[model samples]
Target: MEIIEWWPKIDPTAKEWLVTHNGEAVAPDVLTKIVAAGGSLTSDAWWIGEEGPDGFYLSDEAIDWIEATANGEKA
Candidate 1:
């Protein structure tokens, strides 16, 4: 899956959130968690992937975490 980091300051709603990353929809619980986090987040980057569509990104540390997870390294 591709990871997309959302710009928390500029985004405040689920539709806005989805449009920013070009996504269809996400669970309310997930969106709640994302909004609950403060701005300029340094971790908990959003993970994304689509069929023949877009790529994604995450925080530097989050990227490391993703790599480790994909590589099967325990946290």
Candidate 2:
């Protein structure tokens, strides 16, 4: 599913973290929420910029999407 479709279903903490951290690596708990909300880390390039022992980084597209969404715009 598109991030927009499932964005509202993610936990408030996760949403806040995303907004606050922006380009930082996404925490595991927040990643869990994204998966639970129908987002994919591996299946789509839109979700991940890089992944390794460090953690997941949101793609530029994903970051922009979140920013736009947080700003009350249709991403």
Candidate 3:
């Protein structure tokens, strides 16, 4: 599966715009409106990488962060 980052808007109550293939989306709410108005999917390069990382080199802090996020604990 591809890694995609979904960034919520600053207002926290607006629509979400999808940035394909892990692209950064500033002002995602506005971007979502624009994309919908344009009626198309505008995205950057689609990176086809190898399999996802197997946590082989994940540090203790990384593991903790992942676990916390998995449990829906806010930072």
Best by TM-score: 2
User: What TM-score quantifies how close candidate 2 is to the native fold?
Assistant: 0.83
**What does each candidate score in C-alpha RMSD?**
10.7, 1.6, 12.4
lDDT of 2 by residue, 1-75 (tens): 667766799989999999999988888999899889988776764556888678888888989998998898987
Model 3 regions more than 4 Å off:
1-55
lDDT of each: 0.40, 0.84, 0.31
Model 3 has an lDDT value of 0.31
Q: Ten-residue segment with the worst summed lDDT in candidate 3?
A: 1-10
What lDDT score is found at residue 63 in candidate 2? 91
Give the TM-score ranking, best first. 2, 1, 3
Tens digit of lDDT per residue, candidate 3, span 3-65? 113222122332222222112322435435434444223333132212223311222343344
N/CA/C clash count, model 2: 0
Q: Write one digit per residue (lDDT tens) for candidate 1, span 31-55.
A: 4555454423344334422223332
Write down the worst ten-residue block by lDDT for model 2.
40-49
TM per candidate: 0.27, 0.83, 0.27
